[model samples]
Target: MGDSNATMVTEFILVGMSNYPRAQMVMFVVFLIFYMATLFGNTLLIVLIILTPVLHTPMYFFLCNLSFLDMFYTTCSIPQLLVNCFFRRPTISYTRCLTEMYVGLFLGITECFLLAVMAYDRFAAICNPLRYNVIMSWKVCFQLAAMSWAGAFVLTLIPSQFQPTQFCGHNIINHFTCEIQALLKLACSDTRKMEMVLMINSVIDLAVPFSFILVTYGRIGQAVLRMHSAKGRGKAFSTCGSHLVVVSIFYGSAISMYLRPQGKTFSDHDKFVSLFYGVVTPMLNPLIYSLRNKDVKGAFWRLLGKKMSE
Candidate 1:
């Protein structure tokens, strides 16, 4: 019976954006635009940071990592989503589904940790200006980045090892991607334990880091207020504000999706919420930083002039 069940569920039919059958083409165009923008924005930020020596601070280092992460995060599922819009009944093999779920989870968790580290970078810069360089030395920055990646891998890998390897029943995923919660709804085996594990992981990856960022920002706020120099205060607020905006958008949608009680069925609302972080946030990160940051803008013009001159 178990072997038969496993063999029966080889692929999952993705009921992605299919509810609005008439709007399929519109959804495809929209998603394709978002996907292209995410790729271009993130890749541009990464390249700009690399080519511009002036933007080589700890903040941009983390931003470059984040841009790379956002690119990968969207790539993990968006292309497939864009293609699925063209098909009447889009399907993904069970293996590919599981791979997407795990990879997305890893990237999501890494972003959680990376954002918190970026928050700390802001805290050090604003609250400890005198010690900022020493505190966020190249060695320390690399170590923090390494820890975020390694921590996410361990967090994602261990719990996933215990997840049900087989899924049965109607193999239909309502979400565009093999999201963890959506995938859990289709598990053949008892998922109470897995749900508990996921809950714990959510608290660790989402709750803890978010709380840390909040407290870090609070300290930064106080420090900025105490600064006597108007210019200093403005600079501090400008940089920290950009980071805070990114944090709010990414964490707000993620917490809404992952930290919620597991429901027996996924809804259209859930799919849209997933799109906000999975698609929108990645595209917005670079735009937010580049538009608001003078250093980035200056670097871009300088590089443009250099290239044109050559």
Candidate 2:
């Protein structure tokens, strides 16, 4: 019986942005541009971090980790999506779906925890600069980052284990890739417990980390307010502002879509919002941090200049 279940899936079709027959090409072109921007922006950030010694601080190190994650996360979904958008039949093998799910899970989980780590980094930088180095030491930062990646998969594996094949009923997934919730919705078996697990995951994913960010920022706001110099205030805001934007973008969509009750039919409006969490936020992270940040911009220019010469 178990063997029979295991053999049931040799392939699966991804029903996503490309499935729309009427305007698939237009959607493809739009996503193509977004995809290109995401790739170019994130890659540039990574190169900037590697090439610039000035960016060798705990802050940029975290940003670098974020850049790699954002890059890989999008790569897991976007190009495959681009390919399918153009192709007549956008079929994905069962093995490929599994692979995609795993990679996406790892990166998604990593980003969630990494964001929390970033909050702690901010807390250290602002609230305890004297001990920032000791607290966010090399060993500690990497450990936290590693756990984020590992933990996400650790949690994601729980769902995969119990989840019966939802694809048997409706093979077409309405969003990009086999999203966790969307995939779960396809299951034929009773999913009351599954929905509960998903809620817990979503709440933990959003609430705990966001709570940390909110608290850190609360402290940061206090610290900023005490600075009497307009110049000082500007500087403080400048640093934390990008992170604030990222937190807002990443968390807002997540809370709205995932935190609510588990619904049988997901709204198209919600699908669009999910893009901010999955696709748009990843693209924007590098841009917001790199463009606004002095060290990152300097690193970018240095790296680009060196690359051009070489």
Candidate 3:
């Protein structure tokens, strides 16, 4: 019986990105630099936010959480990717693969909720400026953040507890990282129910938050339009521009990855899309926030000047 064929797999061979043997070293160097930059950029942002009293507000508080998440998010996949780039036949133990998949999924879903909360912060700041402080107080901010993290962790745990029976004897993953969809391909058992579960999970974790962000931004747009002064509009736009850009990139890649028709063969296109969110996005986030944010730039200089004086 097919059930008997589905024995436990001890390890999995990861096919990674390129089949060209000569490209390995080049890929390794590129990804290594990306990993280092991701670490440095996110860590620097977190430290700067903490040291500068100017950034102690709710917006920066969420940004700090975002920076922290970015650090861990990339760590869940990038280091393993770098290592795989060097090995001709890269492999991972079953437990490690599942751990990576679970962590990555948790962080990714948490980010979705966090982005939605950030949009609400923007909405409050722009549409209800008179009570922005009262609305996004420290306690409320903490609760929103806590809920996002706790919800994502709990949701991922439910699925992890009921792993696909099809994967029992399977051991080959076509991607560098232990992506959930990639791992799903190894399952030999019927996966219709599992796929349906994943689809419902995606609807909850991805679609709902994305819709929330859109609605919040719709209110923000209305508020911005009602402002008579061009200066006021510009100020409001500047405040939210970085977050909007980040949301566009993240949600765009995520939707492309998860919203596709299921049961089709996973392709290199999917691998590259995963690469964008898993590796490149984290590295780009700090740069996007810091470059566009004058407050962050000022805080960076202030911190630098104080260090120099010391």
Which is the leading candidate under TM-score? Answer: 1
Ranking by lDDT: 1, 3, 2
lDDT of 1 by residue, 141-241 (tens): 99999999999999998778678766766689888888888888888777788888888999999999999999999899898888999999898888888
Sort all candidates by TM-score, best to worst.
1, 3, 2
Q: Count the backbone clashes (under 3 Å) in each candidate.
A: 0, 2, 3
- What pairs collide in candidate 2? 11-94, 166-186
* lDDT of model 1 at position 190: 73
lDDT of each model, Cα atoms only?
0.91, 0.78, 0.86
Residue-level lDDT of model 2, residues 118-154, one tens digit each, is 8788878877878989999999988887888778878
What TM-score against the true fold does each predicted structure earn?
A: 0.97, 0.90, 0.96
**Residue 238 shift from truth in candidate 2, angstroms:** 1.1
Return the lDDT, model 3, position 166: 56
Off by over 4 Å in 2: 1-10, 87-89, 166-168, 305-310
Q: In model 3, which regions exceed 4 Å deviation?
A: none
List model 3 lDDT by residue over 151-201, tens digit each. Answer: 999889877755775566668777878899988888887777767777788
